[model samples]
Target: MSLWGKTDSFTYIMNQTKNLGLAVNVISDYDRTNANEYIKRKNVLVIIPSLVENSPYTVYECLINNVNFLASNVGGIPELIPQEHHAEVLFIPTPVDLYGKIHYRLKNININQGLLNHKTILKKLGLSQLNEKTTGAFKKIDEANSPLVSVCITHFERHHLLQQALASIKSQTYQNIEVILVDDGSTTEDSHRYLNLIENDFNSRGWKIVRSSNNYLGAARNLAARHASGEYLMFMDDDNVAKPFEVETFVTAALNSGADVLTTPSDLIFGEEFPSPFRKMTHCWLPLGPDLNIASFSNCFGDANALIRKEVFEKVGGFTEDYGLGHEDWEFFAKISLQGYKLQIVPEPLFWYRVANSGMLLSGNKSKNNYRSFRPFMDENVKYNYAMGLIPSYLEKIQELESEVKSLAEHQWWSFCQ
Candidate 1:
């Protein structure tokens, strides 16, 4: 048996397998060429004894290559396997359980049957259908008939990053787009110089730049929205680099679903790595759609970088312009949900979100007193439900406070106070 994985746990895994009297050829490093060659071998059974997993790509790879695999019945693994073959494909992740399954698969090696089942599984999951649907949608919407999307990008002295953001916009596959670059009172000489250089180019491209005096992100976005002429508005931060198909995919989804607001998944990039591949630095953030019970306390409504209908945005009164609170997106999304606006997720990572050590989010964390300022947007029922969700934590805190009070009462100074 050949073992292929990262070097971090190779030594430990080798030791454990050797102790079990299993003869294993360990290949610590993972390479596509080596993996492809290994999978092509006859009578090869891929073993995945993962204790925990979430939508492992190994299953997909095996299915696509028509290779059979025995995986642990954990997480989303079972969901990916065909129901009829679950008894043969899934194991308990224990040595004895894995050994039995391995022996069974080896004895009954039927590549033709496996290949047919794999194709059926892939089709059922809609993995094979996504590309066709996307291509069809793209062909249906031409430049003349496509709705104009006004991309509102807010900038605050990140001139160097702004260049990449603007470049991304220019490289978009969607041609019916207008750029609204809002400069929120940039004080740096470099910022002014860069803006001045791009002014003529921006004007020629029919883009507008709105200048404001340190109004923060919320106000800046709102100001841009006011100047926008498109039917749909897209919000983007100066630090974010959008994928080429970002706008196109969003527009198609909006038209198809008739959703009032749409948000896509994002891959996180640390610092100023503008255009990194998916998950090069960190995991992809798959933001969930708006749910009032969750959105009231958490920002489960995705990022501010979303495509929204202009009328819906206007109805929600735009983003809350609280100076440094840093949750205007959450508040705005929650408001939309409260008012019965249809919000949907595109289910694809179409942008790169830059994560820095210091930003509005960090500053906002320091000012927790203003965290609940968005409560005004929530109605009485929502507030009550949110409070109920906090009851467990509140009760724990109350117990601690009561213990402290009892300890103080037992002190010698307590009698003098009474």
Candidate 2:
């Protein structure tokens, strides 16, 4: 038996399996090459006994390679498996259940059916094989006709992170782009020095560095928007890294949909880890359809890292200058939504959102007063509807009946005493 993985848990598993007098060949360095080679071996069965998972890619890889696999029937794992193959592929996480399922699968394994199941899932996910000859050719838009996108990035003292963010923007597939970096009052010498170096280095690229005095996040974004000279404005935090095709995708989506405001999903990367094409987790936020009712209670809308038409942004009066409050993005989206502007989600993860241990969101969450301050900014009609929506019609009726019963009981008691 072979065990392949790179995390600390994988090491623990390797040691535990050996301690139990089991001969397990453990490959500590886990990568696609090693995994692919192992899967190609004759008469092999992959077992994923995860207690909790979210659409694991291991199952997909096994299916793609026509290899038999037994996975726990846990979060999103069952959804990936075809309905017909459920009894064969999925098993309970317990050792007894796993062993039984493993024995059953080894005895009745059908490689052809597994391949067919893989193809079915691929088709379902819109990833089926494409014919290059019949596929439409790429049409290049005229240079003059292509819209210029201004990527407005707000920065504080994290110059290192800002450099990464700028590098990502510089690597965009769409060439007709200008970057506006807002330096929101950095007190550190290292940050200041790095900003100056970048200002000189990127001056030839038509990128401008706007300086501000401790104006906070919202105001910093507004400052960047003010200096922008493009038809479309894209906002990004300093910690975010845009994908190579992000600008191109947003431009194409904008033109095709004619949406005034556009937002895309992002991959949530923890700590300082760089974004990888193969790394995907279910922990990230997925933008839902536009619903003002849901938006009132939570940010159903996309993140602040969004693409917007310059005219629409100007019309909405830009982001609110609410310093230290993290819900500025939510409030700005709600404001534009209230004004009947079209806010559309692109449904593709176009960038990487770095989630650090301590950031503005953590600080904002610590203060209970933040949401209270934000409530006044919402529309009165929306607030009333949101409050009313919380109580069900049956619950309201029950409350009314209870009130009447209490009043009647008090009157009877007074009458009996008299």
Candidate 3:
């Protein structure tokens, strides 16, 4: 098939070649030498559409000569295809029912359908579109106080959860907000399903999801904020339900209290496990000082319900993404406090925060994501533990952690506080 000007077909083929480093040549009645050269090269990719006239025979001749191929699955062309072409020749779904087909293709966004199951490919396309929309909106914000409010969330194979999370913002009472959902390397069908459902609606509702790979929550949220256009930034959790006044409350707090960061009291309900030590901390939540420098910020806000003015956030360098899962928010408050920024909380609960254990957390995600990222915080934790003589309880683990810190810090893997 021809590259066929600037269109989806052309973009799809070009992106494939660009990403995989495969060469594609849309051929014509070319001479024997050129055809032979293409046939001999194992890397060259050829795309043939069954809808094109008499092209299956031509593509078959090239395939028999050992040319790599991708054929559009259309009509009865498969009946006449050559044997050697079976493996390399991919049958792609043909465009149909232009209006209805596009609509159906869109509905396939959820990845429940067979043809649209190529979610990784679809996500790349989705991310590309996200980049276009986000870049333009971001460019308008010359500084941190851009008119848009950026609410960042991370998601994996939880479209059911994401659809609700995204809808909360899209349906938010505050209309001048932008929602940025970061994928964090989710290749699952559910991820794409959520993407398709949220994509057009998000764009229409003035929310945009930043398309990303598996960078973990800290990195994903940080990455999304870097692309935000609003004067205020709210860090959000995907599984939680926000009240319509969530953003409005945050903004009002920021404006009235003249504080840099504001968060609401979250109402959390635990599952069957009762409550872990970490989960217990979520109870008896209190409002931290409006000026964190004047008092302590031990419980500023869970990553679940924190919002900050963009300038103060930028000033404190956002969340330390390298912290992975745990204590990233703690480090954020510490650094922001050290920078003399105020952190306050709303007295009322404006979000339904679900406190539960995730499979990933139980299946080593907590460890892996936190391992390298938490090393820096562990150093400080160690210093305190050793000073308080709590080292006896953790002698072996401390030694191991100490060695890791020494090796990584010696190599400058982490930027120590200057």
Provide the overall lDDT of each model, using Cα atoms, as 2-decimal numbers. 0.81, 0.79, 0.59
Off by over 4 Å in 2: 1-144, 277-282, 365-377, 380-384, 388-418
For model 2, how does the per-residue alpha-carbon lDDT over 149-202 read when each residue is reduced to its tens digit?
999999999998887898888888899999999989999999999988887766
TM-scores of all candidate predictions against the true structure: 0.62, 0.58, 0.49
Give the TM-score ranking, best first: 1, 2, 3
Candidate 1: residue 362 Cα off by (Å): 0.6
Give the Å shift of residue 414 in candidate 1: 19
Candidate 2 is scored at a TM of: 0.58
Clashes of each: 0, 0, 6
CA displacement after TM-score superposition, residue 340 of candidate 2 (Å): 0.6
TM-score: which candidate is best? 1
Descending-lDDT candidate ranking: 1, 2, 3
TM-score winner between candidates 1 and 3 = 1
lDDT of model number 2: 0.79
Q: What's the lDDT of the predicted structure labeled candidate 3?
A: 0.59
The candidate with the higher lDDT, 1 or 3, is: 1
Write candidate 1's Cα lDDT for 163-269 as tens digits. 99999999999999999999999999999999999999999999998888999888999999999999999999999999999999998888788899998888888
Identify the leading candidate in terms of lDDT. Answer: 1
lDDT of 2 at 124: 60
